[model samples]
Target: MEVYYSKSAKDALREMTCKLIEVMRAESDNIPFNLALSGGNTARQLFALWQEEYRLLIDWNRIRFYWVDERCVSPEHEDSNFKQAYENLFGPLGIPQTRIYRIRGEEDPSKEANRYSELIDQQLPKKNDLPHFDAIILGIGTDGHTASIFSSCHFLLNDIQIYAVSKHPDTGQLRITLTGPVILNDTPLLIPVIGEDKRKILERLLEARTATEDFPAACIVYRAASAFVFTDITI
Candidate 1:
């Protein structure tokens, strides 16, 4: 695990975008670069920065976009993660609609999970019947959750399914999230965690101990792919 402590959230976002551009350029000859995005305050800020600074750094038409997690709400809803990204980044950047793959979270949660799994299996690089992502961006919750996998969510630690349904610990709202197996598959994983509140959990993730469902961020270290941690918190 590598940590980069930037001066502020905007600085961290800029560096992360440069790293992502490099990753995309390296894999340009492949079918398409797969990038999974997480939704939260941090992601919103990052997308805003991408819109202002790095929009032209990569060919948006050649990139495939996926979300790491989504609330079970209609895409038109204000709280929809897809809506946030669309309005803030994708729409402004003129990214083709075909390149964006979103979970139909407003539908039945289980059905949505199955549909997303099938969609990914069709789109992702398949080798020996397993799908692999080119890169994935994740954010850490103050509670140590990543994606919708909360502290008590046990299924996140398993490889049985590509997507799973989980509930927010406080709101009880249902959400769809990619499982750890799918996230850690042969790909580069980037986690950008900022703020002093996340410092303790980030430290635990670097300790390299056995991962428990209680600390979802800890699972990223076990991923076979390269992992990078970009943060603004000081150690």
Candidate 2:
């Protein structure tokens, strides 16, 4: 685990985007730059920066976009992560629809997860016969969840299924999330955590205590993947 502290959230976004551009350029021939996006205020900020500053640097045609998790709603719905990315970055930057691999959340949640897993199995590179993403961008929730894997959702912590259907223990809304095994398979995972509220949970994750169902973020360490944590919060 490596931590990069930025002066502000905006700076962190730019720095991460620059790093991504370099990584993509270096690794383009091996496979298309498969990016798994997370949804939240920090992610929105990063998307905006990509649209404004880093859009041209990315080989949009060769990049395959996927989401780390999604709300079980129509893609056109206001709360939909696909909609948010489309309106904010994909549409504005003219990224081809064919290059975006979105989870069909409006479909049966379980079926949708399976469908995405199959798509990934087909698209991503194989390591030890398992699909491994080139890069996965994630965000840390205040309660220590990543993607839609909430603190109360224990089933998501393991690699049993490629995807899982979960509910926000507090909100009761359905969500489809990539399992930890799917995330950690063979990729470089970047987690951009901002704000003071996330500090304690981030600390706990770094300390590597016993896995708690409530703090699903702790499971990130199990993967043999490299984790880059970009944060603006001071410890």
Candidate 3:
């Protein structure tokens, strides 16, 4: 794991976008570059940056978008992760709809998990039986959650399947998230955990070299082939 500190959140996101473009350009060729994205207010900020900066410059046809996790709700729902990404990024890119493999949050959670699992099996390239994504970008919550993997949901860290369902620890809302064994592959992982609000969480995590299930982000940092953390938080 390696960390890069930006003077501010905007600067960190700017660097993140540059790295994302480079990854897409380098990885996209024979097939659509499989990219999975996490959802949050931070992601919204990044997507807005992408739209304003590189929306027209890149060949978006070479990329396929996937969500790291989604709340169980209609895509039109205000809380839906797909809605967030689509409104901010995917909609602006004008990529083919076929290339967007979003988990159906409106469908039965179990069925959607199976469907997404099948889609992963059929769409992405496999490395030693696990799907290989070109890039998997995620964010960290102050409470140490990443995607839908909360404190008590330690099983998600080792879930080898493509996707699985979890109940939010606080809300009990069903969620479909990419399993760690599938997303934490050999591909370069881009984790942008911005904002001054994350300082305490970053301190606790950095002080502990171990990946505890208590803080799910630790698992990602530990399992990824190489992880790059772009952040504004200073410790």
Using TM-score as the measure, the top candidate is: 3
Clashing pairs in 1: none
lDDT of 2 by residue, 50-126 (tens): 88887667777778899999999999998789988998899999988889989898999988888988888888778
Model 1 segments more than 4 A misplaced: 207-210
TM-score of each: 0.93, 0.92, 0.95
The window of 10 residues in a row where model 2 has the poorest summed lDDT is 209-218
| Candidate no. 3 TM-score | 0.95
Predictions in order: lDDT: 0.82, 0.81, 0.84
**Backbone Cα, N, C clashes tallied per candidate:** 0, 1, 0
2 or 3, which is superior by TM-score?
3
In model 3, what is the error at residue 37, expressed in angstroms?
A: 1.0
How far residue 160's Cα lies from its native spot in candidate 2, in Å, is 2.4
Candidate 1 per-residue lDDT over residues 129-173, each given as its tens digit? 667888889888887788888877856767577898999989999
Better of 1 and 2 by lDDT: 1
